[model samples]
Target: MRKKGAYQQYKDVQIKTANQGKLLLMLYQGCIKFLGLAIKCINDKDFEGANNYLQRARKVINELMSSLNMQQGGEIAENLAMLYEYMNHQLIQANIHKDTEKIKFVKKLLLQLLEAWQEIINGSNTEENIDTNLSINI
Candidate 1:
């Protein structure tokens, strides 16, 4: 409640924000790796590796889903939901037919998603410097 004590509060918030950003970076990295592995497996015609990547991706996705709150309003939530739906469909179709081409297509789509997300992720670095007191949770 005191103005002089606000500095510690501000520092705490910055640390928390940094931690969340790191978590997101980890998520994105995981997705990228899964997609890479899937693409590799597809190119090599390794159905087993492709399946393994899909399972790993599912685990990464589960962590990201925890941030979604369907009962509340969120622009990010809506966008991610749409992406998830599309990704799910593509992944299932690829798996069903054991199709390498289809898996490659889906991997491309995921790459685009990662590139877009990277902009925001990298932007966080710049943001942290100018707005140390700001907090963003994703």
Candidate 2:
């Protein structure tokens, strides 16, 4: 026997869950967009632009993390957490050394991540759907 109120509550929960998933997807895509811009800035030797993009990227990562239930997110989440830390470290080192190469290396890694995400978003079964190269067309 199903209670009427319980069924309504369950329906509400389903809608909320769907909305949350959409929000997560948006956040991930936002991160990738900012990361792509950051790569462009690096390649163009625009340190200020690159730094601004990094701030945006950090915000996106924070939003993505807030959307997750840590314990339930499993290995992918764990790997992302670690990669985020590495990305932060690389950014700091680039700032300290004023090293364009460091920024390039970091941007390459981020590009790979973004391209992989795009592949998944496009319903590709693997990350190979997009070339991970960072060359600028313009």
Candidate 3:
């Protein structure tokens, strides 16, 4: 296999080994990365490239929306669904207008959301570590 094919396989295996929380984190980060790339493409007058990146970002947002478990997640899931929908609409407008500012706005929102998720995951890890270090004697 080619070098790119090997790298892709490695990435797939890494993702497969990650838990759901990490997968969600990766999706948010991927969306932000694509949005940033689209912004740069727009700055360089590469509308076609910008549109491609924006479309990729939209796909990530769609995946995030679809992964939400409304019944179990409650208000949080509903709010995330609305945010994802709004981001998709903004991306559509950005693609149509070739607006770099809108892409920046959306990237900022994704970064903020990603940070929130990171905190939750980090806190969970800390709690787990603390529990593991504790000793209970009967």
Which segments of candidate 1 are over 4 A away from where they belong?
Answer: 1-18, 69-73, 125-138
Q: By descending TM-score, how would the candidates be arranged? A: 3, 1, 2
Candidates in order have lDDT scores of 0.65, 0.60, 0.82
Give lDDT: candidate 2, residue 40.
82
- What digit string (tens of lDDT, one per residue) describes model 3 on residues 1-138? 445688888999979997666777888999999999999999999999999999999999998888776765677778888999999999999999998888889999999988987777666665444222221110
Model 2 stretches astray by more than 4 angstroms: 1-50, 124-138
Clashes of 2: 0
Residue-level lDDT tens digits of model 1 in 1-138: 556578878866755765554556566667768867877887789989888887687666665665555545267667776776676677777776766676566567667766765566566666553233222245
Error of 2 at 3 (Å): 49
Residues 1-138, model 2: lDDT tens digits:
966698889866755764332334455566667767776887798878888877787776665445444465566666777776777677677655556666567667766766675455455333232112211110
Error of 1 at 78 (Å): 1.3
Query: Among these predicted structures, which one has the highest TM-score?
Result: 3
- My TM-score estimates for the predictions, one after another, are 0.62, 0.52, 0.86
- How many steric clashes between backbone atoms does each model show? 0, 0, 0
